[model samples]
Target: MLSFIVLCAALWVSFHLIAGYVAQRLPLDWLADLPIIGASYGWERGGRCYEWLGIRVWKDHLPEAGGLLRDGFSKRQLASAEPDYLDRFAHETSRAEFGHWLTWALALTFFLWTPWQMGVFMVVYGGLINVPFILIQRYNRARLRRFIARSARRSARAD
Candidate 1:
């Protein structure tokens, strides 16, 4: 029981820590809105579907776990209006989403260590822990993309 507790804590924290480091250095192209983890057909909605899940209400509560390595800005909110800054922020969203997905997958290691019943619980725990963050990342990324495009259009018009 004690070991399981320690294992879960270590796994969750370590994955994000390592992921934060990796995300900071990842090529922007790798973070582009592609498929699966990237921008999908419905993501253009800017997370409206997540409204029912109270994302706007509770999302602020989530820690900026990667902030230490992610340029020290709050991912929970917009950092800047600079096109370059917004562009980078959007990429961070993808990086964050990728990290949660990776953590969730590797969290399956919980299943291998515990009994079947406990393993099932761990799987559910993993999903519960990671899914919301995944949604938040996708939702934020979608909005960021739109914001970037709109700003660019507005700039073009002005110029």
Candidate 2:
């Protein structure tokens, strides 16, 4: 059973990596527009719940995690407010949104091979861990999109 769980995890990671790579190589921004991924139902909005959950605090504790796949902003420009930086970071979040869901699906599929109770545990545990990350990506994407829009307006005015 332990080995089965580990195999499930490994499968999840493998699928996630492949999906992420493909998402980067192809144009999949549209995938993020889907309701769950995009949080079209106001999930991305900042509110008391997020603060109470300490999402920001938790994220700060592992700042390195946010930059795992690709460095959103290089060290020297971590404080830079460049438009290009905002765009790159937004794209990264968008890709991550898709990757997380892909992982969720792969993890859930393990239910086919595991005992009913173990399957339920895997699904629940996967959600408990990934949902916050998904929400964070959505929240960050919302902010990044806003910033990118503002930057576009500023650039247009300058032109």
Candidate 3:
């Protein structure tokens, strides 16, 4: 009925608005990487029994001085690389990383539900809901990257 249609539309708008706000708050790169990191950390830490969410502890430590020393040789090589190449590489990597995280988030939602209900919800939301939003986020990210690149080019030209 009309009520059901209205309810669905409201939910759709709410999800996109919330997702956009949350996505903006975090670094686009980090947001893309977070889901994979969260899922991997969750799995490594005994599959959610140890921690329901991944904990991000902000601290600096030096555990690999030797690795740093080794990287010194490659520094010049990295310096010679094209900026656009690096940017494109990072964009692709972030996309893949975020895709994994999205999967994890969906899995967690399903896992928390009762057996039969979980399957039903997953089929409904995973296909119709989450997939569309994921595509939106991806499109947004591509637009953002293009904007950033254009701005940078303009600034460089001005300079």
Candidate 4:
């Protein structure tokens, strides 16, 4: 179990590092943003809707106005548009990089000295590393929306 946990952690860390590098090299920033978005959306959707056959839940909703709105706009807009809905999506991807590094550090430390620690570390570190990206993305989206809204309102008033 300890070995498995360590292996899983190592795999996850490697995946993240590789993905991060690939994302950085891409011309589109949004591509790099996908892991953060996908992780967050998957969590929020409870691995359901999209994970059924490896399809994203949000992907299905893209055709509808509401879904499009939710996917494109920040949490604030989603909340305003769908008053009953909650906005938990993330906007920033880089915020979680440090957490990923910490996870790797902890994993390596445990692998070297205390294998039993791997399980606990995985549980805590996994959540810690992924959750902030969601929050950050949500925050960035909201900030962008607010800026757009303010600008639009100011323009309207001036007109």
**In every candidate, how many clashes are there?**
0, 0, 1, 8
lDDT of 3 by residue, 1-159 (tens): 799557545644454444333433445456445654322332233322222322212111212111132121111112323556445443543443344334434433444444766556645664554543333333333443555577689879999
Per-model RMSD to reference: 2.4, 4.0, 17.5, 13.3
* Cα lDDT of model 2 by residue, 3-39, tens digit: 9668777876786676566555645467555666654
Candidate 4: worst-modelled 10 consecutive residues by lDDT: 62-71
Per-model TM-score on C-alpha atoms? 0.83, 0.70, 0.35, 0.36
lDDT of each: 0.75, 0.63, 0.40, 0.43
Better of 1 and 2 by lDDT: 1
CA error at residue 60 for candidate 3, angstroms: 42
**TM-score: which candidate is best?**
1
Model 4 lDDT on a 0 to 1 scale:
0.43
**Candidate 3 regions off by >4 Å?**
1-29, 35-121
Best by lDDT: 1
Clashing pairs in 3: 35-101
Question: Which segments of candidate 4 are over 4 A away from where they belong?
Answer: 1-16, 26-124
lDDT of 1 by residue, 15-35 (tens): 767666766677656876546
In the range 1-159, model 4's lDDT, one tens digit per residue, is 899767776777675655444433443334335554333342434324324543332333322121222223222233433312222222222323333433444444445555566656765666665544434444344444445556678879999
